[model samples]
Target chain A: MSEVFIFATLNGLVTGLLLFMLASGLTLIFSMMGVLNFAHASFYMLGAYFAYTISGVIGFWGGLLFAPLIVGAIGAIVERYGLRRVHASGHVAELVFTFGLAFLIEELVQFFWGRDTKNYQSPEIFDFALFSLFGQEFSAYRGFMIFIAIAIFAGLYVVLTRSRVGIIIQAAISHPNTVANLGHNVPFIFMCVFGTGTALAGIAGVIAGPVLTTFPGMATVLGSIVFIIVVIGGLGSLPGALIASLLVGLLQSYAIASDVGMPELLTLLGISFDRNHPLNDLWTLNLPQIAPVLPYLLLVLVLIFKPTGLMGNREE
Target chain B: MTMLKVSNLHAFYDKSHILQGVNFHVNAGEIVSLLGRNGVGRSTTVKTIMGEVEPKGSIEFKGEEIAGLKPFQIAHRGLGYVPENRDIFPTLTVRQNLILGLKGKEENGRWTIDDMFSMFPNLATRADVPGGVLSGGEQQMLCMCRTLMGDPELIMIDEPTEGLAPKVVEQIAVLLQEIASRGVSILLVEQKLSIALKISQRLYVMGHGKVVYEGTPSSLLEAHDVRAEWLEV
Candidate 1:
């Protein structure tokens, strides 16, 4: 039991950090632009697809290096020529634009990469196991993912808190007009932030593609979970996102690892419902069976108890 | 030489016509005040000149046309604005706020961070504290100092002493004088008649979105009819 708990924790940490890589970018963009990019996950899909194609030609290292840059350039162009135009129409328009962009991107991906899953694989260097614990071997790639996520988080935290450009970006987040009046090109800053954010999402996609499976629906699988993490963490709060990601990751990991469920709970409480009861499904439910809905359940709870989120200060 | 000249400038907020044919000019090393009651377009005039509001007429800065430029472009060309509400970045520390005010990476500006700290010791002690936690007066000082960090040739301040302790207002008045002494022209939008009368070399009374009265401070002191008609409640 202890071994199961230990391995679950390690796995949860890996999953949580990967989610942060995507959540941080989404939160950054939301805070800066005051609009959520509905197509953020599509950018992740593009990263995976792009990496698959690049890795096929030049190897995994080349794909890892260049896919994010390509996605970032695409993101910048979308902000400059796409979102910027819709911005004047209002917030609803911006949301719609991103929503449409997501569909367009999905269709485009299907057209380019086909509907089938690609044969993307982890690098041969990480194919070996990093260590053996409790009769199970943990792959080096999972450890690598955890390391990269930490490095990205540390780098992002430093740049935002300790650098001059980071200060300007922070100021712009709260007061774009004043920052512009102070002589910083705020629109350009917006473009760069959007680009960088999408690039971060792209990096997540590159790292996650092989493990999660590279397919047209890869984005759909992780996209809603990313939104849940952002909201539960508190919209536009970096630390909130980090904590929420870990919570969701651990909750799901533990749920899937353990066999505890309604049966055990009812037995412990000395209460049992008739097997023919209308709510038989509820009595028979198990933790792993509902692992997929745990994050959503947490989101609902957070929204009910703390509407502003864990760290979000904005009332609306 | 004219540091800023606005002639026949018209700005509309979705056809409300906030500023209509407003004309004004500030000279080098001089402090000019725009005085009027609320909704008289005193704030709109400065915002229009700063490119926050779209202008339909001529705005010449140092003899160069700057009518259609963006706010940042106008700022880069040596124009600074301190808005009425003191729109400080609340989450940023006072020092970070000042740092963001510096134009680009170079520290060649006439005013430095140390200059701001020395001028407002209250801000110096709370340099690491977030702007949101500062007192209203401290935030106002930080806003002004942030603009000063940009080192504009002409700075337009809108209602710098709106809500403050009398002591802080006096400090702001003294700082304005010190700023003007360094040859940075000022276009002040103010509500308090005494501060404007004391600090401004010339005053423009705005009414119905146009300059209704313009004269030296002493001359305006004697113009009771102008004050009663345009400035007085």
Candidate 2:
């Protein structure tokens, strides 16, 4: 009923859906290759920086189109030259390689974009407020973000489930030999899927960069959170990633919006803590302050209780 | 003409040699059985031929040197191998598993999925089920079918009937003979002398990794001293 509550919920949904976009691709790539790419978020960062660079030249829409294309091409090369070479060494080495790649991308971003957040503005057409919800203005760009994320998800779903290429990709994951036998190149297929996955992440970054603040630390901020959404949702399941993202988004959104703390609960329960007490910090702990950590806590719990993930097959 | 030729072959797991100075050959459309007791390098011989092991010496398939080729490359060059464990992709459907082996190189093979389906109707019945769910005999059938889909020029099946029911083993024996009759060279590694004798035109017995005995099935059956000496029960 309150404006603050409605806006927070709306914003939470936007954040959640965007997170699903990244997690879905990461989960699929992980399932197929058995490699958790730590550099996935770095690709997202690259997308933002590329979009920022191109928006000045070809404009916002063109940058959105071209940035992911360039980033995806780079992703394919990374898979071919970096991941494939390290594959024979073992999965752990491959994981460490991606970790190193993530670090490298951060340094590269700083070298190119500097340590400051870029002036990535929303396009002029969507600059105006769309409507008033609960006496508060709802921005058109936020609504546009929701639309774009949904469209991408729907498009990806159709491609993966209904298209012929999707069938080949799925077959490659389960029976690469069979696909190869049927006259498909398995390695090339893997490279394409890896490229597409990273590209999707890049798109997510391009779209969210303006709202989220496109700084060098953008990837670092969202990296672990995206992994939390993926692992919690269930690795390799697109729908699971979607549900988990929304669940996380809304949960954090509501927590941050709501005014609740240990002190308040303690008072309600007829318990009091002295200001000079050793556990004063613990007494004053609030949900909003710790909202960012809920997904990670859930990730740990999922790993402990259900290692296969919420909707995934074991050890995929 | 020989489909597969091996000379003074030696193979090892790490340091310990398993296949020692073994000389063997299988002609096109021929059924040559490698008959030996357990731990006589029968399985290792097949593995070496398929490029699963780094064998020391020369192996030629269809006039091409093939001792050092990768498994997929070897498979591409028309050498089909049915591993002892059956290594079926467990999570995949029976059809998916079979298709994985069909490497599209068989321009004119005697076997097709339809042909294999007709031969082993059991596989067709459970086409949608995961390979792991199949019985041991069924898994062997799936393995054989998978390899057949590849349409290899020469097939090396390692111990197809090692752990099957007697009836199932008999069916597999029949299948091998039927396949051999259709002009596909098969180098069978079998512990069961009866099954091997039923299918093989010729046989070789190995001891300590070297071929010590080679003869026709009847000759092998009749020569008790050769059986008791080189085969040694």
Please report the candidate that would top DockQ against the real structure. 1
| Candidate 1 ranges beyond 4 A from true positions | A276-281
Model 1: colliding residue pairs? none
Tens-digit lDDT string for candidate 1 (A26-120): 99999899878989999999999999999999999999999999999999999999999999999999999999999999999999889999999
Per model, state how many residue pairs clash: 0, 5
On a 0 to 1 DockQ scale, where is model 1? 0.91
Q: What count of clashes does model 2 give?
A: 5
Docking class of 2: incorrect
Candidate 1 docking quality: incorrect, acceptable, medium or high = high
Query: CA lDDT, every prediction?
Result: 0.93, 0.84
The per-residue C-alpha lDDT of model 2 at residue A178 equals 42
True contacts kept of each: 0.98, 0.15
